[model samples]
Target: DARVTQTPRHKVTEMGQEVTMRCQPILGHNTVFWYRQTMMQGLELLAYFRNRAPLDDSGMPKDRFSAEMPDATLATLKIQPSEPRDSAVYFCASGTRGNTEAFFGQGTRLTVV
Candidate 1:
């Protein structure tokens, strides 16, 4: 079945630690997105990619957070020196280039203590 698969479904880390999350998008999908969900912000789009090229990442903190699509099927999001404020559910989604319907992964819940 075609699905978006995310790894490390839950994570707990101390402040100043590094966190890495991975996602495998469904085959044939050309667009991918990284999102962070918080009670206050709701679902915020952190990064966007089409055909494995990053089109926007302005919502992400450039100093500490990064999103990349290393290959056609692999996407990654990393946070360095994570702070408690970064705690949230990170989601990976994929869809076709011209489609509005996106398939979301289960998400990776992160807690920085």
Candidate 2:
């Protein structure tokens, strides 16, 4: 059994700084998703990729945020000039089509001053 893996599980940054989070989705999972969790918004899907191709990213703020699957084993999410509002736990999940369960990473907790 394999599981999604995330790096830098906890992060603290100053406002206007840059932040990057990384994840490794489960092998054989074609669909990968990024999510942001907050008290107000709960869990919001930011972006997703299928077979290493980005399907949609409208949920993310294009001005400062970007998500990409650089290769089959690596996915990255970055935020430049990060703001306090951007502070939240970002999660990575992966699942294949026809699979009802989503495998999720431990989640990267980001804090911006």
**Structure candidate 1, residue pairs in collision:** none
Question: What is the C-alpha lDDT profile of model 2 across 1-113, one tens digit per residue?
Answer: 69999989999999999999999999889989999999999999999898999999999999999999999999999999899999999999999977857889999999999
lDDT of 1 by residue, 1-113 (tens): 88899999999999999999999999999999999999999999999999999999999999999988889989999999899999999999999977989999999999999
C-alpha RMSD by candidate, in order: 0.7, 0.9
Tell me the whole-model lDDT of each prediction, alpha carbons only.
0.96, 0.94
TM-score of each: 0.97, 0.96
Alpha carbon lDDT at 103, candidate 1: 98
